[model samples]
Target: MRLQVKKWNLSNHSDYEKQCGQYCYKIVKTLLNFLKFLKNENDNFNSIIEGKDRQIAELQAKLTSLYSNEHKPNEFDSLRKLITESNTAVINELRSQFLDFHNNGEIKPPYDSLKRCQNESTEYNTKVNESKGGETYIESPYPNSCVPFGNSSKQYKINVAGAGSFHVLCDAHTAGPGWITILRRADGKVDFDRDWNAYRNGFGSLNGDFFIGLEKLHYITKSQPYELYVHLKQLNGQTIHARYGEFAISNEKEKYNLIKLDLYSGTAGDYLKTSKHTGFSTKNKVNIQYAKKFNGGWWFNDYTKSNLNGKYVADNNLVGMFWGDLKILNLVKMLIRPKV
Candidate 1:
C-alpha cells in the first residue's frame, strides 16, 4: 500500500538540537567531577601504602633486636671461653720457652733457679696473706735498677723521697777484697764517700771494678732515681765482699736524693775513714782504712767528717736513694719543700 509521506519540520528540529546540547553538557560536567574524585582517591591510596611500609620497617627492626638479644648470651659465653683458653695457652707457651732457654744454656741455671725460687716464695707469701685475711705488702724493687732476674745488662736506679731504709741486691761473676761505699746527696750535688779514696788515689787498685759514673746514674734516675751498685775486686784474692743493703738520708731540702754504693775488695779492712781539719783550713778528707778482723771487711766510717754539701755524689752506694716509698701526704710535703 502507498503510505502518506511525512515532511521534516523546522520547529521539531530546533527542539531536538536543544535537547541534544543539554545532554552533552550534562555528560561533560559528570566526567570532570568524576576525574576530580579519582585524583583524591589516588592521593589517599599512596598515603596508606607509605604508612603500611613504615609500619613494616619498624616491626622488622624490633624483631631483629629481639633476635640479637636472644642469641647474645651464647655468643658472649663462647667468646669469653675462647679468650680464657688463649690466655692459658700463651702462659703455658711462655713457661715452656723459659724452660727451653735454661736447657739450652743461654742463661745460667743458678739465676734461673733463683728466679723460680723467688716466684714460688712470692706465691707462698701471697697464699699466706690470703689465708690471714690480709693483703700482702709487695714491695717493688728499686726503680730502674738492673735486677738480677732479668736478661738485660741495663741497671736500675731508684730515688727515695724521704729518709728511709732500703735493701738492694746485686749479682756479679767475680768476688774479691773490696769495699762498698754508700753516699748521699748533701747539697743537691753528688759526691763519693771518702772510702773511695783508696781506689781513686791508687793506693789499692780495682782490677775488675765496673765503674758507672754519675751521668749514667742521672739517666737512670731521670725516670727513676738511684745508681747501680758497682762490684769492685782487687788483684789479690785476699778478700770477698757482696754489699747489698739500704742507706738513709735526712731531709735537708726534702728533694729526692741520689746516692751511689760501691762494692770494692782488695786489702784487709780497707774501709772508708774521714779526717777533719778543725782550725785553719776547715777542710775534711775521706780515707780508706784496713780492717784486720774481716780481711776485706770495710767499715763505713768517716761519714760525719765529709762535707755535707747539699748535693749528691756519683759513686755513693746507697740503695733506695733515688726512689722511696712514702705516703701520699709525705710525697706532697717533700715536693713542696724549699730548695737548699
Candidate 2:
C-alpha cells in the first residue's frame, strides 16, 4: 500500500510540472507579442515624425518665397508671425516627445534625423527673417526716381515699365536729391560670390546691404537714359566717387552687355571706362577662367582691373573690391538716376 501511494503522488507531481511549463510558455509568448507591438508602434511613430518634417519643410519653402519679395502686403507681418509661432510650437512638441522616448528606454530613436530637422528649421527661419528687408509700407506709383514720390522714406519702391516694381534707397541728402541707390556694400553681411542667375535676379537687403538686380537695371535704363554714381570708401575713412554722365546696358540675349559707359568724372579713377570688357561675367558663367581666377563676378576681357564683387578682404592675390590700383575697399555704393 505504501508503494502505490508514492507512485500516485509522483504521477500527480509530473502532471503539475507539465501544467506549470505550459503556463510559463504562454506567458513568454504573450510577452514577446507585446514587445513586437511596441517596436511596431515605435517605427510608426518615427514614420509619422518624418512625414511631419517633410510637411514642415514644404511650408518653409513656401514661406521663403513669400518673404523673398522686397515688398509685402499689410497682412504679411501678422500672417508670418502666426505661421512662425505655430511651427515653433510644433517643433517644440516633437522635441519633447523625442526626449521622452529616449528617456523611457524604448526602441532606439533616430536622434540624428531629429537633430537635422531642427537645424534646418532654425536656418530657414534665420534666412527668412534676414531676407525680409524691412517694415512694409504703401509703395509709391512713381515710374522711377525721376518721378519724385516726395518724402516717403529713406527706402521706397518704384515701378519700371518692364521690370515690375521694387525698392530703392533714395539718396535725397547725398550728392543729389533724386539719386536711387542700386548697390550698396557697407559690410560683408551679404555674400557677393554668386552665379549668373543669382547676380541677374539680385540678392541682399534694400534697406541695408543690397543689389537692385540686373534685370531691373536693364529695364530701368532701357526706359530712359540714366547717369551712374559710383561711391566708394577706403579703410581709412576717406570717400571718393566716380560719376558717369551716361550709362546703359543691353538685354539678356546680349549677356547684359555694357552698351555704353562714358563721360566719367569723379575723384575715383575711371577704371571701368578704361576696361575693354563688354559683357557681365559671374562665378559660373562667361569667361569662367577669369571669373574664377579673380574669385568674383565682373566684366572680364583678357584681365580685370576692378572686381567690386570680389572677396570682402584682400586675399593673397589682393583681389577684392578694388578700383584701379586701390584694393580691399571698406565700402562701396552704386546709384543711378534719369540723366536730367
Candidate 3:
C-alpha cells in the first residue's frame, strides 16, 4: 500500500529539482564571465594612464631644452660669432684711420664728420648682427661735465633753442671755484634792450645780494665768441684778497657759443647771477651751487662748526654755457697738466 502511494507523486518532484539545478549553474557561469570582462577593462585603463604619463614627461623634456639659457643651439652660436667678428673688424678700421691721421699732417675739416659717421655705422652693424636675446653694454659719458672723475660716468644731454641764451653751473669739482659772466653784443656797447632781462639775477652773492651790472658786451665778434670771465672778491669785505679762477672757451661757432669756467674756494650762500641789463636772454638755465664753511682750513657744514672764526666760503665748481640747440654729440677725456 505504501509503495503505491509514493510512486504516485515522484514524477513531479523529480522534474522540479532538475529545473532548479539548471538555473543555479547558469547564474554561476554568468558571474564568472562578468569578472573576466572586468579584469580586461582594468588592464586597458592602466595602459592608457601609463601612456599619458609618458607623453607628459616627453613634453616637459622638450620644453626644458627649448628654454634653457646655457644650451642655446647652433643658430644663436653662429649669430654671436658673426657679431664678434664684425666688431673686431670695425675696431681695426678705426685704429687704421687714427694711425693715418697721426702719420699725415693733413688737417682735415671732415675728420669729425667722418668719425661720427663711422661710430653710427658700427653701432648699426652691432645691433643688426647681434643674436636674439643677447645683451649689449655701452659706457656712458661723465654727467654734468664733459669730463668725468671718480666712480660715476653717467651722461646727460642738454638742448637749447637757436639764437637763445643758456647757462649751466655745475659743482666746483666740475668748473672749480671760479665764476664766468657772458654777455652778447649788438651794434656797439652792451645792448641791454631785447631779452636783456634774461641775465638778471644770474649770480647770487654770499650775503644774499645779487650783482646787478657785472656783465657787459666788449665787442661784436668778441661778445658772441662765448667768453668766460672770472673774478675774485673778498668775503667779509673788499679788502681781503681772494683768488680769481681760470676760464676756457669750450666751443665757438657763428651760430652757437659755449664757455667753461673753473674756480676755487668753498663759500656758503655765494652764487652767480645774470642781470636785467645783460645783452643775452636766458633760454635754458642749469645752476649748481657749491657752498662750504671753513673750520681750521677744512670744509665743514655750519652745524658741524667745532672751532671759532669759522668762515663760509663759496667756490665755483663748474660753469658752462651753450647757445643754439646745445648738442653734445661726442665727449672725449683728455688729461692735461694744470696751468701754472
Top-lDDT candidate index: 2
Clashes of each: 50, 0, 31
In model 1, what lDDT does residue 253 have? 31
Q: How far is candidate 1 from the true structure (C-alpha RMSD, Å)?
A: 30.1
lDDT of 1 by residue, 1-340 (tens): 9997644344787876776675567897888897786577546545544553464354345434534453322232333334344434434544564455567635332344334434543443343223221333233444323333343322234332221123222232222211122222223222222222322222211122222322222233333222222222222323222222322221113211224223323332222222111110111221223221111112223332222211232333422121112101100000000011
Q: Per-residue lDDT tens digits of candidate 2, residues 1-340?
A: 5564322233687887776675567898889997887787678667767776776767666776676664433234444455566556656766676677668846465666657666765665565555444532333356456338444338777776556677777875546667777788887888888889988988889767777778888888886778899988988889998999988888778888888788989899888874433788887887788777776677777755677777788443666677888886888888888887
Candidate 3 lDDT (Cα, 0 to 1): 0.30
Against the unseen true structure, what C-alpha lDDT does each candidate score?
0.30, 0.72, 0.30
Off by over 4 Å in 1: 1-143, 148-231, 237-239, 242-244, 248-270, 273-340
Q: Specify the poorest-scoring 10-residue window by lDDT in model 2.
A: 70-79
* Model 1 backbone overlap count: 50
For candidate 2, give the lDDT of residue 314.
41
Q: List the candidate 2 regions with Cα displacement exceeding 4 Å.
A: 1-140, 150-153, 314-317
**Which parts of model 3 have CA positions greater than 4 angstroms off?**
1-230, 233-340
Q: After superposition, how far is residue 100 of candidate 2 from its true place, in Å?
A: 88
lDDT of 1: 0.30
Q: Residue by residue across 225-311, what tens digits does model 3's lDDT show?
A: 232332222333321111224333221121112132345333321122111111221222211011111211111122221111112
TM-scores of the candidates are: 0.20, 0.56, 0.17
